[model samples]
Target chain A: MRRSMLFIPGNTPNLLMNGDVLGSDAIILDLEDAVSPAEKDSARILVRNALKHLHYKGCEIIIRINPVDTEYWQKDLEEVIPLKPNLIMPPKVSCAQDVKTVSDYIAKLEEKCGFEKNTVKLIPLIETAMGVENAFQIAGADERVAAMFLGGEDLTADLRCKRTKEGNEIFYARTRLVCAARACGIDVYDTPFTDVDDLDGLYKDAQFAKSLGFTGKASISPRHVEGINEVFSPTQAEIDYAHEVMETIRIAKEQGKGVVSLRGKMIDAPIVERARQVIEMEKAMFGGVEDDE
Target chain B: MKITANAVAGTLESSDVYVKVEPCDTLEIEIESVVYNQFADDIKASVKEVLDELGVESGRISINDKGAIDCVIQARVETAIKRAGGNK
Candidate 1:
């Protein structure tokens, strides 16, 4: 249900206070790239206090901790894990070992804090060339990895290429990640659309990602949430077609027919599965309230 | 815990408060806030609560607030006290 996860700077109190009301499905309280080194401790304390005192309802709470390679990550985890955010996003993940390292630490912390095992989940940010190469292994590294987030800006830099609106450079990596995550039976998220002002480009980019099997997309700006959610959600026509597919299947089963066809085309297992997914998505999004056709 | 040297935390940004702590002979707290007329007592109470939780005594605590809530004030105070070498 994470169609859009917006990034809110961890140190900015003003933004942190209003994060849940911004229409994002999830709000990522960022401590990695958003806060400066000098203010890392301050930001950590502020974020911890915000989580403890403020009630952010409806939206999932994700804390993007600093990379495992840095000294700040341990401190970040120590402060946030006890509060039990929905997910902890580890950046610059290069391999399965990186995921294991963070997951192992979380397991230890969960025990020490007397919380249920695997209470905190991980969303590894795959941005390096090595990470893309080992996407499959990383996706299946641990049980705590709920999803994989593609960080296009960092990935392009790691690839030694310039990022563009067309996103041709990241095509291979994007497809590879999708295939890996799908094969592992986990969700995959596309990177944020960096150009906040260009709504047209954002829509096209999101559409392309959805076509390539991205379950959802991250957003750096609040303005991109609606467009991303719209792109990922099943359309009215799709929902109606799903309902027809299910109804036809039900009728075929009751009639003792060996085969079923909808609109003169065979409704096979694959089509039925896709229709089920569409129907499930519609239910989740609109609470099973069907719109007038 | 004691404040051995001067330390500051937080920024004067909107919805934030700047906290500074230093060594003093007796406990002293000074607050200058945009919402002074409305929430000065609550702000002082939050600062004192954090200091008490950290076991901080005998220090000069100063707050420059820009309408920060109680949590923000407490966090800033805690961070400043920690930076001043206050161990709890």
Candidate 2:
């Protein structure tokens, strides 16, 4: 799972070329709202060529195409589908049909370009109340969908609610998105923290999202990546306890025991499962170096 | 391909290069770059390479560079050439 997905303006050449080195787990080359209308065509060309030419150093390349209803999205798909971005993020997705529209177009592009089928994934941004209510359907709309992202700014605007750093107004929508994504068995990413200069607020917001079970957070700037990554990653103490729990469970299994105890506390199946998840998460983040004997 | 009309691509922004192409009897390439004295030869070579690849023999290519790298330069030049040739 990604801890942070950095959004870089697709038309900004310097950012597009250097986004991978910013330490984000994924880099989003955004051709949607981040780009101006006059530069839409130019941005599409730049993003397509960037995908064709640049290597993102193992960071998952996610291109945020313009909304499905726009004229720019089809052209964006035509230009970048052959290049095979890791994910195509459709912004302001309101229903399952929005996801299907992009998916069907992608299938056609795959057949025409002869690229490997199903290589391009989709992550629809849930921005409206309809999108949040239909989140599960959208998440399960296509097998190609890997995750769903909650777009708080646009969502608040759509809901006619005030957006504050505490994010109390969006709590219901955020929790609903998490539940929908979990029910669909796909990851969920929280919206970006807009206050770039307020690292403390960013940290608190990221921690809040993590508590809500978001797998990652979107970053508007590279400066926020480090904070989000730290918040999402398992701590050393948690990793050590997970290791101990696993070892205890393994010993119990060897002894033909169904119940296990570690540090005077009985370990249940759920505890053991959580331990395994923590270990797996640690490995995914640290490249399995923590798993070394 | 020969340039038939005036065409331009890209913008005069930082890390971007603005390219202008117009019809000319003889090829004349001019560049104004932030790093003109340092990487002028590399930039000129990149532009020439793209011109050769497009098979454009005679055209006046004016490049207003703002420290764009080779890839950006090549993309801008190719786009300008395509526009000049009335392809897009």
Candidate 3:
């Protein structure tokens, strides 16, 4: 149910302390690109202490550790593992073996630290062309992988294509990731909209992501959270239509009919099932009612 | 155990403390806190409690405090002592 996942730099003390009030469904304490090499150690210590002491109001805490190719990632894991963040996002994940290597490392750490096995979830960032080619295998690499994040900026760089406001360059990459994630029954997230000042553009991009079947979007700033959440949530009209389709299908089932008609439209099994999914998504997004029937 | 080397822990950030431990013949403390006039005594007592718990008999523990809470202060001091004693 993560509509917006915000990235907060791990080196900034003020932002780390104020993370709980930011209103994002999840917070990513970034220890990689946001932190300078000189400040890497300090950021790791700060993030570790924050995870041990601070509470983000039950928001999922995700630590974007340094990439696996660096010396800092091992230390990052050693310090951050004991505290147990909700998810660990590995950057530059170029293949399925990358996911497996990290998963194995986490498994060993969990055993040594006496933590419940498989408690830590992984959401790997697919940022390269190699990663895009192997998206399906990466998505199904491990049981702990709950989602795949498509990183557009880096992917465009890997493709040597220019990034434009219209997002035409990333269409193929995003579409591929969506299909791969859906095939594995896991969620997929879009990269942060880099133009922080363009609210209109952000809205358009979020709407496009939603249409492309992204469950949520990653945000670089706090202001983008509300917009992303709204774009991904099922609208009131959509909820009403879904309920109508469900009711019609239920009546048809009682009458021993294999098909149903709603407003002169043929409602088959797949259409009704999609409607049921929409209703369920609405409930998950705004949880006030329970499905007893 | 006696602190035989210069060791440090924590940082001088908000809600954190930078602790440095040096070998000395007797227990010595130098605390520089933002709230020196208000919570100086309490801060010193907290550091002393942690030092005693670590069985540190002699060391010069320098604390550069930035409004860190009691638990953070204790953790910083304990980490500094362990680093100085080579036990961590």
Candidate 4:
């Protein structure tokens, strides 16, 4: 039920152990980019131990393992997959085959570890241009993928574009990723807003993210989590409006009417669907904000 | 240790997650709970850190102590964010 996922460096034991203290819908213990080459094994050991020792209820604990192409991935997965995290985020996923490959790896690993095959889910990150282009295929490749995220910082670098604070350079890519995820019926997460000090900017960007149809967002800092959660989530006004629209539609249907009007605005099936989506968004955010329908 | 994402279970004391929108676009969070008091500063700091990290501007926040753990505070903040429409 977490809408904003906070990424804490894997080596930072304080943050990792106390991440529930930070207000993220989920927390990612990063054993990938956040861990330098020297700290790799130590970070993994720390995270694996912490995952075993701590109990962060209500917040999902996801481990972002190193990408399959990396030298450390096999060892990383060997140590991590058995911890039974809420989910596993596979970095730098490029295509359907990449997802299938990881799924196969997890399946094999599960048997070796005596765990249920595919008990854990994957959240592939579309961090590269090729990954973005193949996002749909990647998402649809395996049911083990619970959702997917856009890694715009890396994607921008791969595309050879400078990232502006306004996020102008990646608008097209972001839209494409969202469209791809929605089309495939999987949840889509927007890239993190990097300006930790700029709350207003974060706020505006979050609103922009919501309007773009992303279900959730990533956060480099815990501060961005609430903002992202707030921005991407449906407002009470929006939720209530959605309820009224749906209720009106239900009444119209009860009276055998198809197209109807709510406060003089024409209400139709698309409107009902949109309203239903908003209500679902509200529920996803607040957990209790759902329309009876 | 934290609690599960379960039902309201019991409200120990009739409780609420207090929130006020400031005139200056700051989202002020104050959690009033009969249960908030039993928790330590680390837990309180955890709550404050979430509000601070969440990019709330020009707001004053106070969590009324109730005997809530780290997880409950986190869940309450998430609830506040949702109530505020995740105003982002």
Per-prediction count of colliding residue pairs? Answer: 0, 0, 0, 16
**Top-DockQ candidate index:** 1
lDDT, residue A35, model 4: 84
Better of 1 and 4 by DockQ: 1
How big is the RMSD of model 3?
3.3
Model 4 C-alpha lDDT per residue in residues A126-230, reported as the tens digit of each score? 999899888888888998988899988999999999987788888987898888888888888888989899999998888888789888889999878778877
- lDDT for A144 in candidate 3 is 91
lDDT of 2 by residue, A207-273 (tens): 9999999998999989999999999998999999999998887777788998768989999988877
User: How accurate locally, in lDDT, is each candidate?
Assistant: 0.93, 0.90, 0.87, 0.74
Off by over 4 Å in 4: A112-117, A284-291, B1-88
Candidate 1 lDDT tens digits, A142-228 = 999999999999999999999999999999999999999999989899999999999999999999999999999999999999999
Q: Worst 10-residue stretch by lDDT in candidate 1 chain A?
A: A284-293
Model 4 agreement with the true structure over B11-54: per-residue lDDT tens digits: 23222233232223344445555644554556557666655666
Candidate 3 C-alpha lDDT tens digits along A199-267: 999999999999999999999999888898889888899888888887787777789998678989999
Please state the interface RMSD for every predicted structure, separated by commas: 2.4, 1.8, 4.1, 14.1
DockQ for model 4 equals 0.02
In candidate 3, list every pair of residues with a backbone clash.
none
Residue B50 lDDT in candidate 1: 89
What candidate 1 gets wrong by more than 4 Å, as runs, is A288-293, B86-88
- Candidate 4 CAPRI assessment class: incorrect
